[model samples]
Target: MTTESIAGATVSTQANVYFDGKCVSHSLTLADGTKKSVGVVLPSTLTFNTGAAEVMECVAGGCEYKLAGSDAWQTSGPGDKFSIPANSSFDIRVDQAYHYICHFA
Candidate 1:
């Protein structure tokens, strides 16, 4: 797949703070002005709430996740992507470093 660059976008390095430092994301706006975050999660299990719909692509390592309302835990690896609904939450378990790009919709 081809990747498009987000031209003239600003990068924010601040942690979301909700994860209590377990996750840190760098935010950038795409050429079309869509905001996205690329982040790495240290080896830890954490829960996160989302304000918008998200498509999370595993860029390097991977993690297992249990989406809200679901009891099944799914595994995603490099190039794998998962969708989370808006105003929802999910649980993620990382045994090793997990890198991902989160596209907000």
Candidate 2:
């Protein structure tokens, strides 16, 4: 399901801005210490490297993504999800605003 709200989370007020403001997010820590982030990528192509494994959950809008070592670009829209390995990277092509939740695994 699409995450509409994050309950019992301690949110960091300062935004994590990247790519000269093309992308931004706020870090969140749940009561049990699970880490997550809610962010948006504006219209641009950007590469993101992960420190931890992640499940990318789409909440609004969409993006085309090409995972590391892959040639195909896949589409992710509202309610869609994708996974990326730890210490890996992925390329995202955003045609419009792509809203997402990054769930650390």
Candidate 3:
């Protein structure tokens, strides 16, 4: 399989694209075999549900997010990160393309 590097980690290129191309991501396995994804989100407002806890690190650009059970929205930009609990959902709004690394655990 083809490999690519992100956040200093080398990972495979195979991945699943979603939301009618609004989002594209590559699946990766860490040295410890932990699964994660690195992706780009085009300008849009999207809601997502998580089955596992996720740490989303903004690689480029920025977005605003409203976490589950919270009405306040927070903004995150390049070099910033946010966390989502398992079995939760969040709303994200982007005015420009946003790049991020999502670590699942």
- The prediction achieving the highest TM-score against the true structure is 2
For candidate 3, report its TM-score: 0.87
Residue-level lDDT tens digits of model 2 in 22-105: 999999999999999999999999999999999999999999999999999999999999999999999999998999999999
Q: Distance (Å) between predicted and true CA of 91, model 3?
A: 0.3
lDDT (CA) for every model shown? 0.84, 0.96, 0.85
Off by over 4 Å in 1: 1-8, 13-18
Per-residue alpha-carbon lDDT of candidate 3 for residues 1-105, written as tens digits (9 for 90 to 100): 112345555667676677887888988776777888989889899998999999998888889999999999999988888999999999999898888889897
Give one digit per residue, the lDDT tens place, for model 1 in 48-98: 888999998888888999999999999988888999999999999999977
Off by over 4 Å in 2: none
Give the lDDT of residue 9 in candidate 1: 73
| By lDDT: ranked, best first | 2, 3, 1
Residue 18 lDDT in candidate 2? 99
Clashes of each: 0, 0, 0
Q: Listing every candidate in turn, what is its Cα RMSD in Å to the true structure after a full C-alpha superposition? A: 2.3, 0.7, 4.5
